[model samples]
Target: MLVSKYFKLNRSQATLDFLDIHIDKDIPVFVDPTSLRSLKTEWGHHCVSLLQNYFSCVLSAIRKGDDERAKTLLSCLNERNEFHLGYSKKKSRGHALGPASADEIWKSLSKSKAATTGLLTDLEDAVLFVDGVGPDMLSDAVCNIIRGPLIEYTQNACLYYEIPMEKEVSSGPVWNAHLERWEQSLIELPLARGAPIILIPKVVVRAKQSYNSNEYYRHYLMPVLQKHHKDTNSSLVHVLKGKKNKGEKRVYKTDLYELYGADKLASAKLTVAHPSALTNYRDAKKSTQAPPLDHTALAKLENIPNPDFPALLNEATKLRPGSKDAYLYEDAIEKFISGFLYPSLSFPVKQDGIHDGRKRIDITYVNSAKSGFFEWLSRHYAASHIFVECKNYGKEVGNPEVDQLAGRFSPSRGQVGILIARSVADKNLLLQRCKDTAADGRGFIIFLDDIDLRELIGQRYDVISGDSNHLLYKRFKALIS
Candidate 1:
């Protein structure tokens, strides 16, 4: 439910649907290179930066004795108290400060005594020493904030394809980067193994709580830290946590000791790695052979209503070239792909691009389906994310058309694309050009005309027969090869 809520909040309906299919069918979701890159570079980096700013602002306010500003920032974290890093019904509050009044917070701050100074006049010092706004509270806030997005990203990765969590070992000496020591314990989500990793900066650890004591941290964060703590070649070295102060930038450890005192500082545990350290090991472990298609599910998918392709084609034929009515062809092709080719595929956005917005990708599909022969063909060509270009032209598709489709190919967007046209006179030449692109390592292009489109629609019901889709794929493969 947390995973569902997270996706509902951040992802589009198409992405939500893609995740739903995997959860309902209990199949692995396949994440393509493009999606993975976006998750790590764009989403991951943005989350880390936001959290760092929040931490810096709160810590700075506390250090400078700005109680009002600190309270305001602390409330931002408290608002999301209902959710934690992991999905569970048992309400473990973790380190979130409860909904106590500002008066109660200030009163506690006034009554509190500093761990080193004995008693404190400054309300900020009292607040730091008191129960609600101490180092532990700050650590927990960082953990909870980081956990929400980290778990969501991990769940999305799992939906992209099923990568099993590393099994827990009964007894092993695990390295604690924060403590700079090794201890004998059950090594959970060991970094030496093949699980995803998220690094937590040592500056964020408030109290030295064991990793497993907190349900969310144990389930979500520990595994990632365990897997990469000792790897020298790991990206952990390049993170913001690992960086040293060059000039005027405040040193994290020194600031904590100066503000929180030596006694309180002794309790803090830290790691010098960015909180969003993620390395996708899914591709290295991807199966060369795809799992078999579920015919029952396919049959059920076929029952879902789709546009009348025959009618769409007739309407498309009647519409003049460059007419806005021709846009119906894109809709028809989208339906054809979703209904006939793969149910997991959904068009999330149209005309997607960056900068000048000169290039508009006609249709982009987020393919989450792991079953079906066509799905296998896509996986075979390493195209988990698919791009489709639809043309309503009555003329033959030329090299220029083929080149446009090929231009969209990348390791992230996928090295395969589909070009749909009303017809083509030089089919051989187009096929030859596609082959040339494939040989050049740019991408593989498939051309579909009116005849192929009709054939796909006609065979939509034949998926129950199991071999009909395979035969169709073979025909397409032969044409392109």
Candidate 2:
């Protein structure tokens, strides 16, 4: 009975009698070689992407307004869909208002009057503008139907991004009416605090037949298993499971999923410390239920006794609790750019991340050569600085971080918003660069190291406020000024 609870197909007589339900004759089911039932349609893949964006927008507060504030946000959402401006190329940029990325578009939508979960039930009016659709079709329409309102509610409902109040996705007020309840939950967690999180199914049952087999197991299944090894060197079954469980441990890898009855795993006993535990803690399925079954489900997995690198780092530091070092961001930026940019640039660097919170400065010097930094400065004024940041814990150094930090824009601060990495990855700066806020990537972040920074020991000149807005370079004011 326990085995049959897991969504399975009945192919045999005994198995059929286990539950005394003859599904084979009454309800015909088709199974491919992999043995798992296929979803209603493949539309799930495309639509799910759009829906995830909507949910994320609603769940985050740092990015509060969506569909509400900015008129240009509509253009950003058009990227993933065949959505058009319905006008000529000349008119395309007309809708290109202030919204930056899809996320930012969500923020603008959140502020709209129509951004609510209840509003989603009104599928008719909303569907008119949607690209392709009918009552029954294999289109991304369903996603759009639910998305518009979610964005509305995110702006209208959620006080913060991370703490959502709704229990689950269904047709109800929890998605809309309970917005205030959701807002209060963010006191502890926030959207800016989000790190990489994922949910991985521990066990899978493949259906029979080439199409179902290849589609279900290979398409959806293998990729996740492969992902388990992205940062590690071992296979899912090998390194992930740790020790062995040869006792009454039930195995489901088989030719026919009939091995599992309808009541099998669908209602199996919670198995914490079994073989379904979330790993790297990134895959945990947390909940606010009075008694969270998901957490109990997570306990099912028997974690490998030990893991190296990040796991070791996690144990040693248990980081991400409070604030992070203000200067650690520079290291990540250097590492990322070293491999990312085409024909990337390189340089020697140092860190001064740790602080006593005693009004210590974030940066001291950069290669003040009158050539790259100072040369441009001399042409205009007298300045020598490439990228320097001041990691302020308060509001924002708005100008310095946004203007000269990133180096991407003509007159950007520091050329990057390099936030100091304390326990979190990049807690200092928000990802999107809001032009309304600051142009050159929001308050460019740069983290200090454990030791005092001494990257540029001896430089010819000093940083000077350059020709404010150089045509092609930054104008620095010489320190000798």
Candidate 3:
């Protein structure tokens, strides 16, 4: 069972901000540290700092010849099956660093030329130069180092979804950057089948590791060899076989690899001589942005079909307003909105609390909009966070609804929101009320009734071409005009 299904959240992978991982088997995605470093969010910055601190500590231990400390640091990375990710063939038994593997890892790093010469600057660098360290191990090591932040994210998500968590579970090996050591704490954690569960943000994961030996060998190393052989007129250069380019000849790295057996140490030696290639590779990886898994990819991993949009809309529209199951309608609306405005808005916090729990916003999405209306709102209205209020009322949404959403806004939280309701008896009056709020410097609110929502839902494909926000733009225009 997937985490969403197990928790009865009634949400699919399409609408979730995190990967809805299965409890029994591992999903074939890995957390890419490069992606985290490339993020512009506060959470992304924090995760990067944690990873750098922990990895730096390990390097310091190795450089100082403190074998015990280095080994001890490595030993913290046990099999963390809670995440339920990676390439496990069956159950989620992680192949992370255990005691034996930790010793081997320490030995490899302690004797490595890359480690001594400062070539191995980050965890991703290990995949290029270190033996027995691949994408899976690198990802596991990162998860261990940044486990604290992941735990906090999981807790916040659980609170939003009303998923129950066990109190005082062990938080394993959180890196205390200030103190330069590891620490453990007892905290609340969700459990499944007698094991702990930690949620990973979708933004920080990729289908493949950003820095891999295969890509380095092909793109970086081969190009360097090609330049070197061309400069010296080395034996590796060969003439073209086809008549299209009769006299053309080029240095082929494949022939060189055949000669040197495609060894990492040989490639590392070449990198040491011509370091610009490695620098170029790192620079490229740093700039490239890897998108999170889409709805179709998420469904494939869960062995399910794509989200039925028409069915989702039908379910939301059919629910009786103000009934005992009104919450279901709220969930349905959230699903539609989340799926509808994704990539533009993400990390939706359902029923987000404010003013120390005095009030709650129905759904709050982090403004990750790179282009289009949400991005425009961010620039003009300071909408770093987009607040949403879901009203399942059968009557017209009035001042109270607008006022409620406005109350949740502030200088830090943002001043823009979307009000989703079943119906509005007078949308122009509601828009006038919203306009009044905007005029008073309180906030800006846009109302989306079922009809408007249907329109938005129909234009969901426009999100890709940056056109899906036209409906929202129209509604927002009425508020200001």
Specify the highest-TM-score model's number: 3
lDDT of 2: 0.25
Better of 1 and 3 by lDDT: 3
Q: Which stretches of model 1 miss by more than 4 angstroms?
A: 1-318, 321-326, 354-358, 461-472, 479-481
lDDT of 1 by residue, 295-384 (tens): 333224323223445754554455554436467777555545644444445433566673357677787766554455545655567676
lDDT of 3 at 405: 91
Better-scoring candidate (TM-score), 2 or 3 = 3
lDDT of 2 at 260: 25
Q: Show pairs that collide, candidate 3.
A: none
**lDDT per residue (tens digit) for residues 1-481 in model 2:** 1112222331111111111111111111111111111111122233334444434444343244333423222322232211111122221121211234434434423432223322221222122111221221111222222333333323322231122333322221112222321111212111111221111111111111122112323333334434444434442233334355432222223312232222212111111112121121112211210110111222232121211222222221222222363333433323232211101111212332323442222332222222233434324531222343434233333445444343332232233223332222332343233232333223223333211122111111121222333312221111111
Which order, best to worst by TM-score? 3, 1, 2
Q: What TM-score does candidate 3 get on C-alpha atoms?
A: 0.88
Total backbone collisions, model 2: 106
Q: Runs in model 2 with CA error above 4 Å?
A: 1-142, 149-252, 261-481
Q: Please report, in order, the local distance difference test score of every candidate based on alpha carbons.
A: 0.44, 0.25, 0.82
TM-score of each: 0.39, 0.18, 0.88
